[model samples]
Target: MKILITNDDGIYSPGIAALAKIAAAFGEVRIVAPDVEQSSMGHAITHSRPLSLKKSPIAFDGKEAYRVNGTPADCVALGLHIYPDTEVVLSGINMGPNLGNSMWHSGTLAAAKQAVLLGITGIALSTPVGKTEPDFNAFADYVKEALEVIFENKKLGLYNVNFPPQPKGLRWTRQSVRLYDGKVVPALDPMARKHYWITVTPLEQAEEGTDRWAVEHDFVSITPLRLDLTNEDELKKQLDSAVELNKQL
Candidate 1:
């Protein structure tokens, strides 16, 4: 398999290196990623400016590599366009998790989403933050297993995989649905200028089987994400209601 690897954590992050090592074991690898961190950038592309790329060698076993001055989505776009034969696109071993509602704003997930839009299979991998820091080597087995299942199921579309701090095993999970207590903290800089920092405190879910719950319980969460955002149930209901109202009028 020809794998195209990309990430939102920039080209030099250890997370990407770990991911590259795992990908190298599968087949020939090619990496195209941002020259700098593009975290939380979502599926943004370099629309206004001419996107540029340059060769930036890393310690991966990839056959070719490039660094882009663009978002993670742009990296995947360029990688697929440049290497038209790429069979799979793997985005991240992101330093942060892209779970629940966060996937909508995660550049890591956006890379995979972009690849899927281009009619290619893609997966996004992420690890949780913990006090022990990361030991990527420990995640090799879990990462490889996720790849195995993904490869076997080509029609799975976009997948978001998040490993717990210490993974016990993997679980197919649903995305969590809950609101966050997002706050904008105010602070003053040394120059006495007031600035605001946005922070999130996630609300607890009583429900299990969600990505967030699985991860919190030491399980690797794999949620199959889709490009289609249509809520078909609501759509059908609203359409029916409209038709009934028209008949009454």
Candidate 2:
């Protein structure tokens, strides 16, 4: 299997390197990622300017790695264009966990989403970070195990996988749906200029059997995702109500 690997944490991030090394065990791996960090960029594509891809300054063992001057989504778009035969696109081993509601704007997930959009299997992998960077070596085995299980499902086109620092096992999970408390914390920069940091705090705890819950309990969480965003139940309800109103009228 030909695999194209990309991430939002830039080309030099260790996360992508670690992922490339493990992914090689599965098939041929190539890396194309942003030259600099583009975290939280979502599925953005550059329209105003032409993007560029250059050989990466850092090496990923002997894998063919390149850096792009674009978003994570852009990298995948270009990578697939370059390696048209790529069978799978793996994004991340991100520096931070992309779980629950955070997936909406996660560039790590966006890279994988781009692959699926182009009719290829896309998988996004991530893990939590601490005061220091995560020890990817410790969870290398789990990463391999998760990929093995995910590959068995040929119909699952897109997936989001999160691993704990130490995983006891793997669990197929659903995305956590919960409210969040958004806040903007005011602060002063080194230049004494006013600044604000927009952030969110979860309102409730993780529910059982969700991606968030699985990772919190030290299990690798694999959540299969789809491209459609339609709420079929709501659409059906509106259609039924409209039909009833027309009959009365």
Please name the candidate that would achieve the greatest lDDT relative to the true structure.
Answer: 2
Per-residue lDDT over 129-245 for candidate 2, one digit per residue giving the tens place of the 0 to 100 score: 999999999999999999999899877499999999999999999999899999999999999999999998889999999999999999999999999999999999999999999
Question: Global lDDT for candidate 1?
Answer: 0.90
Quote the lDDT for 65 in model 1: 84
What lDDT tens digits, residue by residue, belong to model 1 across residues 1-249? Answer: 899999999998888888888888788899999999999999998889899999986756636889999999999999999999999899999998888889889999999999999999889999986675588888789999888977888673889999977789999999998888999999999999999998787887725999998998989999998888999999999999999999999
Clashes of each: 0, 0
Considering summed lDDT, which 10 consecutive residues are worst modelled in model 2?
149-158
The Cα error of candidate 2 at residue 218, in Å, is 0.7
Task: For model 2, give the RMSD to the true fold.
Answer: 0.9
